[model samples]
Target: MKINLFPLLFTIALFYSCINNQSNKNDLTPKPYKVSKNFIPINKAPRIEYNTFNNITQNQYSFTNTTSNQEVSILHHLDETGFHFYQGLKFKDNNLGVIVGGTRLRARITLNGGKNWKEVSFSRFANSFQSVDFSGNNIFIVGASNYIYKSEDFGKNWSVFDTKYFFKENQSRYQKFKYYKVRFLTEKIGFIIGEHERHSVILKTIDRGETWKIIKNNNLPKNEKGISDIAIISADELIITTLSGKCYKSIDGGVNWQLLYSGENTTLSSIAFFNSRTGFIGGSNNVLMYTNDSGKTWKKIHMPYGEISDIVIHENNAFITTSFQALDEAKSFIFKIDSKGTNTPLPFLTKKDDSVFFEANSYAIQTLNNHIYILDKNNLYRTIIN
Candidate 1:
């Protein structure tokens, strides 16, 4: 048998030629796969920040990305009072946004990814706005003086919902429910937690704000510190942290609540769940508590910082911001807690912290398009992790 050496050599040569051609087509330096930053720059450069004892005029903000821990971006807002004491921040997308805060009925909206922000004049609401949450196309704002407003068209127009029904027929300070935080699981199902003088109130609306009813639960304590933050895991599972450092868990869509954890002289300012069963409750006096058995029990974690004002989980990492109850800005810090609940303070603030500028006002942290934002009354800092 004569082996066809010529044809076999020809086929081998063709195969090597095809391999070389494909290798040449593939560029060795493939562009790094970039997760979108979705950054929107501020139109005006930031002005000098003014920091008094209790008052802070946040004119500028800068952040250290978690991946590099280097200065990435700085954003500036208005050099006015309405931008002070920011109660809440929510960005609908890379462009449209809303922030509710200030002494007067000061709420503002940004059209171009927070480059320029304009005051949203809500004629019907006259008190300081506290919390804002959006579900689908509906936006809900709740605040001091027992008021809740709903917007159907992304905050263009808002309608006031009658919260007067939460109180008795008689109008009294002890009877009036002062709402603090709100969360909506869907357009129709939502929950708002607040407190009267002696009673903690949880209001539920199943009909998309058309009607709201008080969740009747005799389990809540009297003269409680009130619900400061709430995390809605699903239609049935709900968790709320109180100003008095107590956590309540409700499994039946606010139908009933059980005491998850309680501590004397501890105030929990914020609560967040990494998942349905794991969560953390944080607040003043350097309190940071964790629960893994669906709030059945909680263990206190040792933290060097004084007050844990906010806790936000992104994947396996949990970011927390803290400040001194006293007037020491040096103690203010941000710590990145890993999945094992190990506290490692990120040095993102060491370089930026001047004796005058304070990082203590961090009240909220949010993530959008792989960028994390730390927000307070006067400033918003952006960064990245991993």
Candidate 2:
């Protein structure tokens, strides 16, 4: 009657042991979370950039990436090495920078992480050089006079390929016409488009640039249009825009093309397609057209007022850099274009009195490793602290 003390004590001890076991389990379990900076558009300020400049005066930046994201660091800044201009960036075990000199001179700089840079020079092939793009182990740069050079040797020595559509006839000026830009989606397949006689011309290479031929897409009229720039949206699709604001789609590589916009007044300087279905084009007249369905139908993204030279879409966030913003004569600026197509200006790139390179080269804006690059006034600048 007094009580079963031993049995009751045994039950209490068992319960305490189970409670201790559960508490220890809870302590050992890992918690789920993030350490900030993962969020988007969040910034102390925003910036703007240009892609291709007409001249020094035409190549100034008004907007800047003022957002002080710590992870985004400007690894290196070299005014001397960059020289007159630098084009095309390739990131491998190291980051390589290809600089185009004033007189067809070409040099490359390699970076280990964000540390020091190693300069690789090629003084021999320094005549009439242009732009560069990467495909796996192959590094390629093309220049004026139909000079296309490829480096399977990691920028050590380059082999000149026969991109002879321009030089074939061997005319003096037209033969060495400055081929402005080159892009490669893969090592084996790539496309080159540039101005020929002030008109857009398209070139295709099947063997990485060893040999090339014109993309005989006979259907899309106007052989005179100069294809100023092209982007590989996918292996099978491409968004081709020219100086004439002529937007063409080539789903089967460059073999065929179809006009998506007719009579677009402003010249489209740069084109970017995040996916096969989503794309954006920066054109004159402050026009930026976005298409959700590849290039089938496009809707103009009204920027209120800015001459957008290039448009870059990273996930849901879209970035457009303009020559100048009409708002209060705000000057040229780089602002973040959001999902709703609204514009958020970055003070870092657009801040007044902040000097910019690559004048009005509205076609020279590029984003890599979160650092903003503007090739405006025949020079290049990196957003370091900002």
Candidate 3:
């Protein structure tokens, strides 16, 4: 016998081939990313119960104390401007403020806090202005069609900069670009976030608003959604929320970014940080999350069914505004979240049937002194917080 081992060798080769094929098939299968276990359930979190009341006759609103039945009037001022949809509100100080909006590119200024507002005219190249921010006397407003209007005299005059020049190579590929938010970390450094056809772009201005440079393409995440909001913790550390509920953090002054948190398929509209380690993110579908360890982990807080339009932190407390709309109903609410994660709904409420209520859309929130100014679709509301 020649001790032939051909059949045995063939069997061994066939077995190894099957194992290799099975290994590759396993590798191709998708695996779920592990969500953090830091979320606090609604039942376990501290919640305050307060009654909301709106007095149509007095043009005021009030919230009842959670512990006591004492009614406290919160509505300090309400400006009912007809049909003008305000998109962004910012206060340069306790007295000077500016609000930019749509409905033929309207801009309003108030010198006496929120007590009175007057329309300020500006040259219109875009139909709407989405965001407004100020660095000293230089006010920057960004809007549709890649237009950025800068006013060195505080909305007295305007100079427009078409950001399309930054994207000259792909300008013809997209019809228009919309800038959602403009944030100035300091007088000389600022950022404008927007998208051209759902692809997000961030522009950095190092020399005030005179010039801008696009953040390097390789430095940003490979996201295809718009950047909804930016939270600047410091000149070097910053965080941004996206339309698809993604959060990115840049510690090197927007030079390099890393994905901080992946949201649960919601649109994160606003993000604000009270300190370097504490932050809050709000978005669509009642998504409100907080992080205490910078951006390392996040904990979701239970909120009423509504979309969070804007968030602002005052005195270490987060003030949130929410708007909910449906075919037959519309509602808006203001809530406050303390540092301990306690949620208290401020007594401000609006209904579709109200004479002053126009639409339950977005609310731009700002805090000055001890008051919160909210710019709604057709009205401006100022509420005192103590």
Candidate 4:
């Protein structure tokens, strides 16, 4: 039997109370990045389809090698029922990878890249794994109800723990904080961003996952809008995005903060730093923002697609996926762009017969060995960029 638990922790963020008791809410402003008003024409990648049991259809996106102009693709089918849906993807190497999703503590691992995958579900009810992160051999999976499962091995086995806690003076109820994203700066230093009681919460762990403590600082946001994601650029530098499209930065750990950007009303779901000097943040309604000189300033990067889901940055290329809140069978797209110059979103086809594919939510985007992997709903599509 699975253990069902309710969400315990909540948050209330207070926006803009930087150090020296100044309100950055009136100061720091974001500049809009140059974007092409014209949409780049997108062509569907050549694909091979397979019919599996239970009326499931598998799609393989094949593309001709740009250099050789020869078609190339591969196909692999997973028990679509095992994961229900894939929410996160993390690859340890070119071969080994893990995916987490579903209302339960469901996870799947692949040892030989993605040629094959095996289901590895936890015994407890985890309410859908929200995020999967790793560092060296440590694998951490966080989800609803403040439950956190960790694996020291290469996702072979797992251990479960919770971030539930109660303030000393107000111990009437057990306040559990549900974590959305976990980022590790080092083996022992890491941070988890989530919500508690409609406000934002940031938990830090110094002794690995053995114990965690809440980081209470006055400079942080204290409103009903919760934090969407976090990017730890360096040991002292940190940036976090909010549901209101507001961005905050801290140069001295969590001591002092500055409101970097505030203009949009949509949630910024994903954030990543290529380095301490370069970063990207994206979320609902074509909201893609970039920073060059750390978090001092930011600008909106126009994307052809809206409702940005996931983004993974390679050396000179950036892979992004977009999807909607309401699930639709028609719309799903994964975009690849050359970050060195101006780029645009590349559209994709979900149904071969229908040229009008647009409402599916893309969950994860990954790249390995020059091949791109995109997860939409229960189907996984693979393609190679020429």
CA-only RMSD, every prediction = 26.0, 26.1, 18.8, 17.4
Pairs in steric clash, model 3: none
* lDDT of model 4, residue 16: 24
Q: What's the TM-score of each model vs. the native?
A: 0.74, 0.65, 0.72, 0.70
- What lDDT score goes with residue 172 in model 1? 41
lDDT of 3 by residue, 288-332 (tens): 888888879888888866689898889868878777765644445
Off by over 4 Å in 4: 1-83, 123-126, 166-176, 206-208, 293-297, 325-332, 338-341, 346-359, 368-371, 382-386
Instruction: Give the 10-residue window scoring lowest on summed lDDT in candidate 3.
Output: 45-54
lDDT of 2 by residue, 20-100 (tens): 999998777643322221111112111101122211111223333335432323443444433344444445433554444
Give the worst 10-residue stretch by lDDT in candidate 1: 39-48
At residue 381, candidate 2 shows an lDDT of 48
Clashing pairs in 1: 66-384, 86-377, 286-306
Between candidates 2 and 3, the one scoring higher on lDDT is: 3
- RMSD of model 3 against the true structure: 18.8
Candidate closer to the true structure by lDDT (higher is better), 1 or 4 = 1
Local accuracy of candidate 4 as per-residue lDDT tens digits, 218-280: 677577366778878776788888777777888888767788777556788877667767778
Better model by TM-score: candidate 1 vs candidate 3: 1
Model 1 TM:
0.74
In angstroms, the error of model 2 at 142 is: 2.1
Cα-lDDT of candidate 1: 0.65
Compared with the true structure, the alpha-carbon lDDT of candidate 4 equals 0.63
